[model samples]
Target: MLRSLLPIVEHAVKGPVWDCQMCGQCVLHETGMTCPMTCPKTLRNGPCGGVAVDGACEVKPEMQCVWVKANHRAENLPLLPQSWRDEIGHLRAPVNNSLAGDSSWMNLVSGADRKTPTGWKGSE
Candidate 1:
């Protein structure tokens, strides 16, 4: 089924393009397809406010700031659902490593996961 094939396909396609870590809770749609793994701080929302003048990452100056690009991209798209828009910085849940490299779509289908934003925490 399509759910079973999602992991393999995403790893192949998004892995190289986005440096995806296969965290099994894809936020690409909310993030303008920008992978948070690309951020040195692993920030899921937006930039850390330390971006360089050219919109380069502060932690890795040579790289473009993903959040900046995501913000810009969001502007041109149709309005997202209020929840998605409200979750710009707060929606990221802790990655469940038990599900790493698996199908997040399947997780959603099984009610094991959701795209809804959750509170940040230091430990489970």
Candidate 2:
């Protein structure tokens, strides 16, 4: 019951504002409120090298590069807590496919989202 309902509520609240993709491991607080999962390439850490010189997305030329926007927001967005913005430089772990469609709010509280497969390069 907890798992099933959390996703619906999470999506309903976050979807309209952030266009969240419910990757089951949310890093929006660290990401300047942008949803990295919504990137055309779904890049977790940062933007692809294909970003144009003008800061436009290479995959979707009309839009600004997601990372470019994230960085700007992380620095300039008012009312962002300093601790949440401090992690912008961290290397986000790769997506855990098994957790797709699950509730990230629950995963976050239980620390389930941080579990990497054995031998994963991101594992400590």
Candidate 3:
């Protein structure tokens, strides 16, 4: 199917370079529409001091901070359980390689192998 072939074609032409938005919607929406995975700072309760009055991130001035965006989304939806929100605050995963190498998108489309763990030592 073309879906499966597209990644291979892209990889062949472009190597492994890809862009990631790092939106935690996948984890947030299902659990309670709360995103912890995407936000680099991983703020649960609210936006950190980095948030500008207009709701832009200090780190990436052009972009709306993840926490600011998440807060807005959460406010529109029903209130999420405090425990679920709290749990996300502590959970952190390396956003890039984690998705690129291991995502089901790559698995189904490209049949790419998961990236070797950091500092892995193969036996001779």
Best by lDDT: 2
Write down the TM-score for model 3. 0.38
Full candidate order by TM-score, most accurate first: 2, 1, 3
lDDT of 3 at 87: 41
Winner of 1 and 3 under TM-score: 1
Clashing pairs in 1: 91-117
CA displacement after TM-score superposition, residue 105 of candidate 3 (Å): 6.3
Best by TM-score: 2
Judged by lDDT against the true structure, how good is candidate 2?
Answer: 0.90
Residue-level lDDT of model 1, residues 1-124, one tens digit each, is 7867889887888788878888777777777667776788878757898999899999888888888887766555566665554455554666566777777667777866563335545333
Off by over 4 Å in 3: 1-48, 78-90, 93-98, 105-124
lDDT of model 1 at position 36: 74
Q: How far is candidate 3 from the true structure (C-alpha RMSD, Å)?
A: 9.4
Q: On residues 20-120, what C-alpha lDDT tens digit does candidate 3 reach at each position?
A: 23331124532235444445665434467877888887777887777666655544555666665444444333333444423344443543333335865
Off by over 4 Å in 2: 121-124
- Taking all chains together, each candidate's TM-score versus the true structure is 0.70, 0.92, 0.38
Ranking by lDDT: 2, 1, 3
Q: C-alpha displacement of 70 in model 2, angstroms?
A: 0.5
